[model samples]
Target: MTRDLLGRHRAVLPEWLALYYENPLEITHGEGRHVWDAAGNKYLDFFGGILTTMTAHALPEVAKAVSEQAGRIIHSSTLYLNRPMVELAERIAHVSGIPDARVFFTTSGTEANDTALLLATAYRRSNTILAMRNSYHGRSFSSVGITGNSGWSPTSLSPLQTLYVHGGVRTRGPYAHLDDRDFVAACVDDLRDLLGHTRAPAALIAEPIQGVGGFTFPPDGLYAAFREVLRERDVLWIADEVQTGWGRTGEHFWGWQAHAHNGPPDIVTFAKGIGNGMSVGGVVARAEIMNCLDANSISTFGGTQITMAAALANLNHALEHDLQGNARRVGGLLLERLRAVAAQVPHVREVRGRGLMLGIELTRPGTDEAAPEAAATVLEEARAGGLLIGKGGGHNTSALRVAPPMSLTVAEAEEGAAILERALRSI
Candidate 1:
């Protein structure tokens, strides 16, 4: 049955849509942190469907809200006064840290970012954008144009003249040997040097932690340092918190807070996990930036009633249950356990992340070269052992990505780590 469905899918779906493993399995249903395939195989879910399932699978509150809202209304365009949309917007604004903020909803992160670009370019009256060196935003033409990762970036042609910046990954860059403070200085120097050569940029966009770039992180306060330089040129700072928002980082609610000593960002774009799979995405900015457009604009399916209902329920449940604390506790334990496992494996270069968003990079035994085959082997072995994980990196895809639900329990973390240890050993 799986084989037949796979063949049919391949015949119809775009080839660029990549699948996991040599034999990809179809996930039929899920509950909590586990999912069942079409063939009745149950495996522990760690990637959370690319970190979209912020809570658990089949969350009762969210399901109930969706069902109840559907009974009344699924969608009403932006023209109408949407109670759920307004309520969610109020909650988001309260937590956004931007004073006198305005929110605009979109169906996906790509659109939210596109909205951000429109705002920044119009406000600053500049078309130039600065993006990080190894980052992946989305597949849309506008998003891809700013993306610096060569593997994911399909084209160099773009309406926005995007210039790539440094300091996304600290472990393997030109200044890898430097200490943390020196590394920050070097990146700032690079930024200042670049700013001197080009026209004033409208905005400098970045992911707090590069998700698709092997979950790599820069030294703390890297962005804050760059903020000083960008501010001199009147450049807007846009934080792409699609993966790092809502306390997934253990220490910060929004990833931008890591660099908040300077001041809040001018604009913030968020999606993924906010709706817990309900397709909620939006941008929050000071009224001045969001209202820069002279004419009217609306997102047809942006804040539809059903999705807003789900988002409200999901947000309340996540906060009320203190899932963020759970992520900090369980995820800390899991990270330590994985580090111990990595000490025994030569190919395991590093284990990095915060909260549930974790990654294990595999490299050649004695060299800096990434070991993609080893990553593939561990993924297949983990699946055989009843575990589901993910793989990501810039060019070689050599890092095992493990971002389970924020509500992951300690026992589940232990079990998942044990299975992952065996997978690493097998590799």
Candidate 2:
């Protein structure tokens, strides 16, 4: 039956399509932090659907709200106001503490980022955008253009080189020495020079923690320095919190809160965990910048009835359960356990990240060189051992991205870590 199902999907889907369904396992249902495959095999999910399923898969409350909202109204054009939409926006604003900030919602993280870029450009009336190297904002044209990785740049590249400047450390090529402080200073100086040579940028966008870029946390005081530079140049700071937001960092409710002493960003974008698996993404900006947007610029499907309901329910659950506090406690335990495992495993190079958004970097036997093949083997082996994980970053895919549901318990986390340890030893 599983084979037949897989065969049908393969036959109907385009051959050119990238297949995440290859070598497939049919997961019939999920609840809490575990999923059951077609044969009734249970697997512990640690990836959290690439950090999207915050509350957990098939959360009863979220499922109930979604079903109820769908029964009444699934979607309506933004021309009319809806109670769910209004309430959800208000909830987000209240949690974020950005009073009177306008909300423009979208179905995906990429769309929210695209909308943010448009608003920034329009408000500042500038063509150029400054972005940090190794940042993963989104996959749209403008967002991709601002992405600092050439691997993401396709055959049809944007003709706006002057409009995009890559700042921060160059992680690839012979020019990779940009990791040094002097090199970072030089990059900043070059950006200032570019501002003088070209024009002041509309915005300087970056992820508080570079998620896809190997989960690399910038050097201490880097965010403050960057914020100061943007302020001096009259450029907006855009914190792309698509993956890092919603208490995953443990330090605060949002990733930007980790850098709050530097002043808040002009605009903030969120998506992944906003609805705890439901499709929802949005932008929250300062009142002045938000007022620059015209109503016509909004999305027709933004903040639809069903999405709003799900978002509100998810937000309420997070606050009521104090999931952030759980994240801090459980995440600390996971990190400590993983670090201990790293000490025992010769292949494990580093374990980095805060809260539950962690990464375990695999390396060659005796060097800092990335061992992607070994990492891939570990992931597959772990899956076969009844644990699910995800991959991210490293030129060759050496990092295992561990972003479990914030509600994961210490015992469950320990089980996942033990599976990982067994996989590593087997490899």
Candidate 3:
């Protein structure tokens, strides 16, 4: 509604409902890689709507597909077959290389993760799930329980049945002090120890490239080792590509491809970029696992005509434009430029990430603790200067997430970086 309405609701709503920015800007419209506020001031959309709008805002094809679908038919219960849903599923499976994969659609990333968890637990008949620490899955009951962040806790959901494994800490990079071989060995050892200490787990879930946990990229060989361990234990390996999927990471269509040596995961979840800012999420699970999930295990507003049409259109657009390739080229340029900026400003701790999903971590001049306050000041200043960014990670650590549309140009990236450079200088 209105800004005043948000403020009023903040006072009366639960903390969860009020967890967003205290003073949220009212965006009126968006096109390509920018958005205009109600007052008509434009801001470069570096955050890409939390890395969801891979194709950019107000994409003509996406809008047209949604409109046509709405005019034709919007919803039909899962009781009957739907063309858009069937087509989207085929496209997803084809792109994901999970032939014979079954698709289950949902309204949001959280729902997809929730469905994965439910199916994993039921299929394995095990109560324990292993998830990486500092990783984020979703905000729903089961998904939140498995998430490593403390923010998603205290749910009414019963049994709290998940185990936590140590994610690579930010003390340095993913392989900070170790070589690839040693890192892989250590991960294998850790998984073995974790399993030895507890009951067998139904699934091991992790973000291929940590998103909310500061865009941490794991070391080479680590994923392969983890996958090996999961295979040995007959544990399902669930790759949560909610933030890194849809060619955002450049090298692959999904984040897991960045770690290709690990082989295919038992189940993979997608959202954020699937519908290019519209609401759509789905899971691609191995045929065996899909068959194991009881028929009608989940049901809701999934695979609706409007959402399916948008998803199909988005997929087609991504394939036609080779957005993944664009993500690689633009992301490399952005990272190179940001690294240069970081060098100029000693306060900038590190710049990392693949493809378009990048993060700039600002730290105290001489301390390890992130300068979140400084980051916030810079973010506000950048917004004022016409670039929109986002912050995440535990403690709201000084990590600025940069995930612009794959269609974002080199010039835009350069300009956005310059604006950010000025913001950093101001701080």
Cα-based lDDT for every prediction: 0.93, 0.79, 0.82
Q: Per-residue lDDT for 229-280 in model 1, tens only?
A: 9999999999999889988987788888988898889999999999999898
TM-scores for the candidates? 0.99, 0.91, 0.95
The residue-level lDDT of candidate 3 at 8 comes to 81
Task: Please give me the total number of clashing residue pairs in predicted model 2.
Answer: 0
Candidate 2 regions with alpha-carbon error over 4 angstroms: 14-22, 159-197
* C-alpha lDDT of residue 76 in model 3: 84
Q: Write the per-residue lDDT of candidate 3 for residues 1-427, one digit (tens) a residue.
A: 5678677867888866533344678788999998998778898999877888889899999999999988988898677888999999988887776757888898899999988887798899997899887788888778778877676555636455777776444345344567656766766787899889887799998898888888876765566678787888789888898998888888888878756775778889988888887888889998888778666554557888898999899889988999999999999999999898888887787888888999888888877677888888888889878999888765455788888999989999999999998998888
- Point out the worst 10-residue segment of candidate 3 by lDDT: 167-176
Q: Which regions in candidate 3 have their CA more than 4 angstroms from the true location?
A: 1-3, 11-13, 18-22, 154-158, 170-175
The pairs that clash in candidate 1 are none
RMSD of each: 0.8, 2.8, 2.1
**What alpha-carbon RMSD in Å does predicted model 3 have with respect to the real structure?**
2.1
